[model samples]
Target: MRQTFHTSGPVLMGDQTNSQEFHLSLEQITQAPADCTLRYLDFHGTQAKLGVEYSGTAPFTRDGIKLSPAPEQAAPLQASWCVTLLSPSASLAQLQQLMRFFDGQQWTLVAADTLAQRPECTVIRFQIEGDLNFDRARLSCLRVADQLGADLVIQAAATQRVPALAGFDMDSTLIDAEVIDELAKITGIGDQVTAITQATMAGDMDFCESFKRRMALLKGFSEKRLAEIAQELPLKEGAYELLTALRALGCKTALLSGGFTYFAEFLRRERLPLDFTYANELKFAEGALTGEVVEPIIDGDRKRKLLTEIAEKLNISLERVVAMGDGANDIPMLNLGELGIAIHPKPKVRMQAPQAINLFGLDAALYLFGLNDRQIEKLG
Candidate 1:
C-alpha cells in the first residue's frame, strides 16, 4: 500500500523532492531504506537530512519529525536509550555529525533536545534506539565525542529518571583540592604526600597503605592547622549549585568520601545540604595527629558498602541511585549505583566508569537526568 503526503514546501525522498506533494509506500515510511535519504524539519524546527537504509525489523525516525506510517502500522519499539552530549564548544555542525554517526550505526535518532545552551557550554540529549551493544556503542560514541571536544553520557532511558539518592566523592569531585594533599602542603611534606595521593587515586597503590603512610607524615600536625585548611577547602565549580538543585528536588544526598571525616563533615555542616557524610577518622591526641587512622578505612569496598547501606536506610532502590566520584577508590560505589559518573577522573577510572564529565563542572550532571536549563533554574 502507498501513503500520500502534502507539504507547503519541499518533501524530500531519497535524491528526489516535490514542491507540493509526494507519495511513499508503507514499507518506505516504516522500514529503513538502503541508499535512500529523508529530509524533514526536526522538532527544534531545524532542517535535518538523514541517510536511511532498509533494516527489515528496525523502526527509524528522527524526533518524530519524519513522515511516518499510520499509527497502527508504526513499529512497537521506540527509543530505548538516552545519550547526552556536553561540551564547552558544542555547535550545530557537531550535532549533525552525531546524527550521522547514529544513522550509520542503524540507530534511530528518536528525538534531540538542547538541555542547556550558553557560550561557555552546551548540553544536548539524544533519544535513540536500535540493536545496541551498549558498551561498544558507548565507546564508539565517546570516540566521536572526543574528536568533537565533547563529553558523552549514554544510559538506558528506563533508568534515566531523577535519582532518589545521589552520592558524591569529596576530593577532586565535589571539592577543588584533595584534603590530604592540601594538608601535606601545610605540613611542608607536599611533594611526598602528593605522590602517594596521586598513585592511590590513579589505582597504582593500595589506598590503605597510602593513607597510613601519608598520615604518619602528618603525625604531630596540629589540629589548628587542619581546621584552618578545612575552613578554606575550595569547592569544585558548580558543586553548590548542583547540591542546591538536588535539595530542591528532595533527593537524599551524601558525601561518600575516602578522605577524612573532619573535612567531609565541615562541608555538610557549613556548605552543602548533605544528609550523610562517611569517611575515615583521624585519631587525635593532645590536639596533634597521632599518625593513626580509625579502624575500617573507607576504601573502595567500604565505599560500596556504605552506599548500599545508605540506600537501604532510606528505602531507596539501587536503580534510583546516582554515584559520582573521581578516584580509583570511588570505583566500587560508582559501579554500584544505577548511574555512575566519573568526574574529572584519572585515565584508568574514566575507562571503567559508566559515564564521565570532563569538560564542564559538576552542575553539568543535571543534564544526565534529562533535565533542561529551565528546569534547573526552576529547581533553584
Candidate 2:
C-alpha cells in the first residue's frame, strides 16, 4: 500500500507569496524507492525545465527543490520544548502515562533523560518537538502531573548553558521554616504573626505593612533568642547539595531575601557557601530587638533590583541567572531570572512564576539545567 503525506505552506518567490502543496508518498520521502519520481509545476504556472538526480539514497536537491527523509528534517513550524517532571515517589507507570499523554498531543518526544533516581525523589526531563503553545502545554502537563502526584515544568528548550548566578529566597526556600514566623514564636505571638505572614506570602497583604505589623508584635524580643533560632534553623532538604553543585559549576550564589540579615548571614557563614547575602537588617539595642528594621527594606521590588545589580556588577547576563523563591514578594526577582523557579511556592506565586518545583528538594532543580544524576554526582 502506498501511504501519502500532504504538506502545504506559503512559498515566497522574490516579492510574491504563493501557496505550495506537496503530496508525497511515504516510500518516496522515507525510503525513496529507486523508480520513484516527484514532479511539480513552477510557481509562475509556466513550463519550466527542472532536473532531479538521486545518488545512492542521498536526499535529492535542485535549484528550487529539496527533499529529504522526514526523520532527518525538522519541520519549520515545530520548536524544541523541555518538559521536566519530578516527584518524590514517581514510578515507571507514571512516566509511561506522561509519555502517552504527549503522544496523544502529537508532540514527538526526541529524548527522555532521567536526571535523578532515588527512592525519595525522581526527576525526568523530556525534550519534545511541537508547535509552541507554552501556556497550553504547561496547563496540560500540570493536569497530568497533578494526576500522577508530581510536579511538571515546561519551557522552550533553549541552548543548555549552566547559569552564572543563582539567587534564592531565605524563608521556605533555602530553609523549611519561615524566619518571621520563627521569630514570632520567640515573641509569644506565634499565632498572630503566623497569620499575617501567611497572608503576606499569599499576596493578600502588603509585604512592607505586614512586616511592620509583625515586627511590632516582636518588640523587645531578645537578640539572644534570635541567634539561637538561627543556629537551629533547618535547611531545606537538598539545599546544601544544590548549592554545592552550583559552586562546583562556578556559579555565583546569593541569598536575596525579605527576611532579616542576621539569619541570612548566619546561613552564609555557617551553613551554605553563598557569594552574597542581602536582607533587611534588624535594629538591636541592649541585647534586645527594637522591633524596627533598618532603612531600605528589601521587599519584593528590592529583591528584583538586588538580583539585577548583582548580575550587572558581576558582568553576568540576566539570561545566565536562576532565581528561586517561595513567596509572592519573590515573584519579581523570580521572573527576572532566565529560570524563575518557585520552590513549593504559595498558590499565587506558583501561578505567576514561569516554573515551579513542588515535588522534590531544591536539588531537583539541577535537572532543569539538563544535568543527569551522573553529572550531578560528579559535580559533588
Candidate 3:
C-alpha cells in the first residue's frame, strides 16, 4: 500500500485518505535486528519516526519527493538500495552517518521524509528502474541495520505460554552474565567484560576461547561480586510468567547456558523450577578472581550434552522440549528441542531457529504453548 510520511509529523499508512493518521515511533521501528529479511519491524501501520530514501530507476518520488523503492531493488550499473529511517532506534543523526557512508559510492539516493511510529517488518520489495548491481548496497544496508539494532519490526501476538516445557539460557538467557563476569563488573572491568559478552552472544568468536579470554580479564575479581550481581541482573521480559505458566501446565522448565552459576543463583532464589542451570565456574583468590577457570568450559557442546542428560533423567523426549536463545552458542540446544525458539536472537541464530517469538515479550513464547494472557494471569 502507498504511504505518506512527513519530516515534522507522522507517517500515514493504510487508508491515507482518512484524516486519522497513525504515527509511528522510533522505539517500535528500533526494536533493532530480528535476524531475518523483512520480518516485522514495529507493529504494522504503527506510527514511526522513519527517515526514508529511494534508490531504484524511479527514485520513490511523489510530487518530486523521493521515497526508497522498498528494501531490495535494482538500480543502474552501480548497485544501490533504498535506505529508510524506518524508526529512530538509531536516531536521525545515525541515519545521517549511514548516508555519509553511502555517499560518493557512485550511488544515487533520495531522502524523502521521516515519520513517528514503527512499521511492520516485511521481506524486500522492489520497484527497480531496471535490474542492476545492488548486492553491495543491500549487504551494507543489512550490516548497518544490524549494528544499529534498527533491523526488525515487532509483530502482534498473545502473551502467554503454551502447555509445554520451556527451556531458557541461564546466563543472559534467564538472568544475566556469567558469575565470573559479574564478579569482574564489581572490579570496574565491566566494559571489557561485556565486550566478551557481546562477542559470545553474537557467535563471532569461539565459545570456550571467548569464555576463557573474558575469564582471564576477570583476574582479581571477587566472589562477593557474584552474589551482588546475581541479586541485581535484570530478568528477561516475561521470564517469571513463562516459568510460572510452564510449571502450571506440568511442562518441564530448564535453564541451560554457556554462562556461569552466580547469575543462576538469582533465578534459583526466585524459586522458579530453573530445572537445570549449566555453565562454567570462576575460581576466586581468597575474594578476587584467580585469573583461571575450572576445567571443561561448558561451551555449546556441553550445553547440548547437558540437555540430553536432563531429558533422559526427566524421562522427557527431546521433541517435547522447547529451547530459546539469542546467540549462535544456543543453536545446538535450539536445534535439539522439539520446538526451538529464538528469542530476540541474532540474525544467524534466528534464521536457524525453528520458531521465533517477535511480538509481545518472552511471555509470547507461552502463546505457542497454548496459554493466553487471561490464563497466565489466572495462574499468577
The per-residue C-alpha lDDT of model 2 at residue 182 equals 83
TM-score of each: 0.80, 0.77, 0.57
Output the lDDT of residue 139, model 1. 79
- The TM-score leader among the candidates is 1
What RMSD does model 3 have? 12.8
Q: Which stretches in model 2 have alpha-carbon errors above 4 Å?
A: 1-79
What tens digits encode model 3's per-residue C-alpha lDDT throughout 1-380? Answer: 11222222122344232111113443433333221112122222234323332222211122222222322211112112233333223233344444454443543332222222233311211111223344444445555555644432111112112424556776555553455465556678887877777777788889888888887877776567566666677777667767776777788776776766655655766646666676666677688777788878787777778888888888877667677777788888877866666776767776666555433346555434433234445677
Residue pairs with clashing backbones, model 2:
none
lDDT against true structure, model 2:
0.72
Q: Which stretches of candidate 1 lie over 4 Å from their true place?
A: 1-78
* Candidate 1 lDDT over residue span 1-380, tens digit each: 00112211122345343111123232233343322222221232233332222223223333322342212111222478988777665443455567677778998777655665454565666778799888888778778877767788888887666799999999999899988888889879999999999999999999999998999999999998888888888899889998998989888999988899999999999988899999999899999999998889889989889989999999999999999999999989889978999988898998888888877788888878767676777787
The ten-residue window of minimal lDDT in model 2 covers: 1-10
The better candidate by lDDT, 1 or 2, is 1
Better TM-score candidate (2, 3): 2
